[model samples]
Target: MAPLENLASGRGAFAPSSGEPASPSDGSGQSVGSGSSGRKRVPLGNSSAGGGSTSGNPAGDVGLGGSSGQPGNPDDPFILPQENASTLDKKLKVEVPMEIVVSCGPNGVVLHPGGYRISPGALKGKGAILAKELRSIVRLRQQVDPMIRPRPSIEFLVEPGGFDTYHEARRQTVISGLDWPVSLQVADTKVLDFFPGGRF
Candidate 1:
């Protein structure tokens, strides 16, 4: 008879035998290494059930692929569209009144009511000189005038035939002197002609 230790060693105690098959079912009907027949295995944490993709395309996942509208053009749209020269003139033109006053004395010119003054030597042309005088008058009024209303639009009260020498070009140059959006009119103390004949 073998010693107890020899007998245990010969029978391979504490080691599993390779000849016996692993149990396919241990109370749970599924196999230890694979699923049962006719059953499909699914991976954990799939996103398909929520109607989205794992690729992370927000628009594509919602079935909106290529449906997003194009971006707006950065160029200004308010600019007037191009047209024939005649049409362009009609669309883009502005009118401002021309009023003239004459002071030939050594004391120079004084814009009455507003009291803004300019020198006789400063009179280069009827339009240019008068525009400068008007601008100065506007500045002084903005500073000292007590009226709380909007600054009054300028109107030229020319003496009779005072601006007869001013051609269209000279008139335009004078009109450019005032800030934009100003209303202007010209009159001879009785008859008035609003500039630009038509609405802007």
Candidate 2:
């Protein structure tokens, strides 16, 4: 027996089996025994179902017997198609708020804290949305000015061109340029008031 160290080190290496002289090749090339001396490469890639490599079987489609190139080369390899963020976001589908606008008419009453719906059924289409504003005015009546302002006015006018004060609204009644002092027939100004958030 060669020294295990010498056998391991490849230093004057001894043959694997005793008593048999070294052949043309030391038997590591193909089949492992003393009889066989060469290798026979076979192309049996078509045996496992004709499409094994090209048949949509994901794993078999690679270079099984080195027939094709490397496994991941784009030419022979199939990579899963993927969607980018925009496509994926559309696929997943999330809604996001963009902007907000504040108005003082039918929708304005909702901005203030403790705002309430006018009619309990307003949201359900049974009553007017302006109910809250009417309720608020009924609660606070001292601020009412009956002279230039209409009684129970749903909204005080800023006098069209834009006035900074109530006194300005009181004094500003000019219709427009080329407009005479002809009295304008107007409907009684009573608008339903509804705000959101305050209780009924």
Can you write out model 1's per-residue Cα lDDT over 100-191, one digit (the tens) per residue?
A: 33322334444555555555445544657666655565556545633322243443334444343222223543566655343323434222
Instruction: Give per-residue CA lDDT, model 2, range 1-200, as digits (tens).
Output: 66886555444454578944443434343333345445544455345564456434445644534334444644535565567976765555433221111112332222122344222233224333234334344434323432121123223322222222222211221211212121111121221111134210
User: What's each prediction's TM-score?
Assistant: 0.32, 0.20
Could you give me the TM-score of model 1 versus the true structure?
0.32
Model 2 residue pairs with clashes: 51-55, 115-198, 116-198, 118-131, 118-132, 129-194, 130-193, 130-194, 131-193
Off by over 4 Å in 2: 1-79, 94-108, 111-200
Query: What is the lDDT, from 0 to 100, of the residue 120 in candidate 2?
Result: 20
In the predicted model 1, the residue pairs found to clash are none
lDDT of each: 0.43, 0.33
Q: What lDDT is obtained when candidate 1 is compared to the true structure?
A: 0.43
